[model samples]
Target: MKKTTLATLSLAMLGATGAAHAQNSVTLYGIVDTGLTFIHNDGGNGNSYSMSSGNMSGNRFGLKGTEDLGGGLKTIFVLENGFNSTNGKLGQGSRMFGRQAYIGLTGDTWGTVTAGRQYDPLVDLVQPVQGDNWLGGIFSTPGDIDNADNSARVNNSIKYTSPVWAGFQFEGMYSLGGVAGATGSGQSYAGAASYSFGQMNLAAGYYHLSNGNTLAARLAGTTTWDSLFNTSVNAAYQSASSINNARIGGNYTFGPVTAGGYYSYAEYTADGRSLFTRAQKYNTGSVYAMWQVSAPLQAEAGYTYMHSTGNSSAKYNQFALAADYLLSKRTDVYAQVAYALASGTEDPAGGQAQAVIGSATGDSGSNKQALVTVGIRHKF
Candidate 1:
């Protein structure tokens, strides 16, 4: 009888442990944003309109969960995917979790360590108040020059974020290239720091990519007529061996108004000693101010300037204005307009023009491009 009772108790304990182990939860959340965009150019191309997504914020769905582990530690996981709102197609070239996918352990005092495909520190520390994240995407900082849009998500990465101390924190990330023979060949590294004081915030970050040869070659080989016309250069010239980006930015708020600015620099070198083996440097800067006109209405305006120097010396200047009306806490409507001019260079076919980088045509003829977009964004 004693032996039988002992066995029964063991079974009950096993059942209780199993139940406790399963006491965790997961949640699904997402945002969907879309709208119409219109572009006008001086070449009598008139105006073109199209559907777009993530104008205000990227459209995405994510699954996240956390499990409590008795003490002050917890296990967490997140899987997020970006998608197009128009056709419901996967974004980021069909990657399942193109936006983010990671698992980590957290402690109350130490910090968190995560491993997986994840964003670099640049975006985490610098993008929160930038135009791309706060105002709209139309005026993104030169293809998010500082990687503020998380443009440089690292694969096979390990990242650590430190606990905040006196309103200051630090972050670091390293990506394993996953190349068997050349372990460090394709790797990347990034670091950042930030601080907050009252209504003011500041951050600085740096990023470097080692073996971007493949990425550069791919970008160079893909050529289209539009690229030649708008950018004043062939696709080959747009490719770079590796990239180094650095940025510093901050914002200050007083009552119902806020103002901020940032400067970013990118250095691009050719992949090999080809005839186009010349290094190019791109410098960009922007500033803006925003005001809450009323309970539900707000207005923002900004300007940006870019300079490209090297084999081709070109200049680009842009101005933008936008307004937002909050319909509810989770939904808002907005409209934006921007004008850009390109000079000091000619189209690939030797015509002088001003055109947006992605929409350039061979017919230079002093080109000018303007854009207007109206959209609605909803978050959950």
Candidate 2:
């Protein structure tokens, strides 16, 4: 009897220890991707080898943990950082947590609320339909002009996501400026909603920002670039201070083929009336189709058109095509090429202009621009 009692006691202690460990959990995850990219333009022509992070998805290392608090409630946290896979350096201007960092709580009925630098609802709801996300980063539109998926993250944000109902859900976010006495300065806000049913999905979103006077000041201070390009900077800065953007996008899948398009519009108002007083408007439209030719081979193509009006009127049209072959479930080889042309005074200066202001290289916009990229990506 004594021996049996001792064994039972030891077993009970082991069970208690296991329970303690289960209450707290942590996980590590990341991805690594690299490729070669080549660009041809009027300013200069060269073939360069480069490695980039987040080609298909941003390369990142992260730690996530959860502590069960009982009664369907849990405390969770995530700290993620982006890095270049080729050179192993920090991304997003060297910010340590450039990708994401947030802490939050989850409840079964109430949904989740998270704080810190996190993606806005627009990115969550709309980016999936963008070719940029589908084709990787190389051939994406300039600066993801649409901000379709909130390609640009807002700082000091608090976000709330709702539980799904009938395959529909919504989210909202507010980025606190964190600047005292200036309640609206440097702050950004966004909201978005999405619905998914079977193979069809749809989303719409809006974003607004305020108090970007500093950006304008910096542009005015710089004289290295000419007026044409300088004005572009001024226009962009002014728009940031008082800007609005809206988008609607959706995709439908039929067997191995999917087709979709998105429309986006943006308006920027200057801080004070000047040449920049008139609200600058940017409208963009894009459509794309993709098909899986074989079990491991796929092809995709897309086109995007943009028109900027207000301080100046510039027209841009771009076309892109890409192909990919899966080496394995987690690895793929791909190639993509894109061409862009501009009309009006904003045109590339033939081969004489090296970079276009808004173009990838910041050279003159007098000539056509092209980019070809071939790369390999692996996910983990």
> Best-fitting candidate, measured by lDDT?
1
TM-scores of the candidates are 0.84, 0.82
Tens digit per residue, CA lDDT, model 1, 126-209: 766565556675455433444545544677889999999998988999887665575655577889899999999898888776
> Roughly what TM-score does model 1 have, to 2 decimal places?
0.84
Candidate 2, overall lDDT?
Answer: 0.65
What would the TM-score be for candidate 2 when compared with the true structure? 0.82
Q: Give the alpha-carbon lDDT of every model.
A: 0.68, 0.65
CA deviation > 4 Å runs, candidate 1: 1-15, 18-22, 42-46, 213-239, 271-275, 346-354, 357-366
- Highest TM-score model number: 1
Model 2 lDDT-worst window of ten: 1-10
Off by over 4 Å in 2: 1-22, 42-54, 213-240, 273-275, 345-366
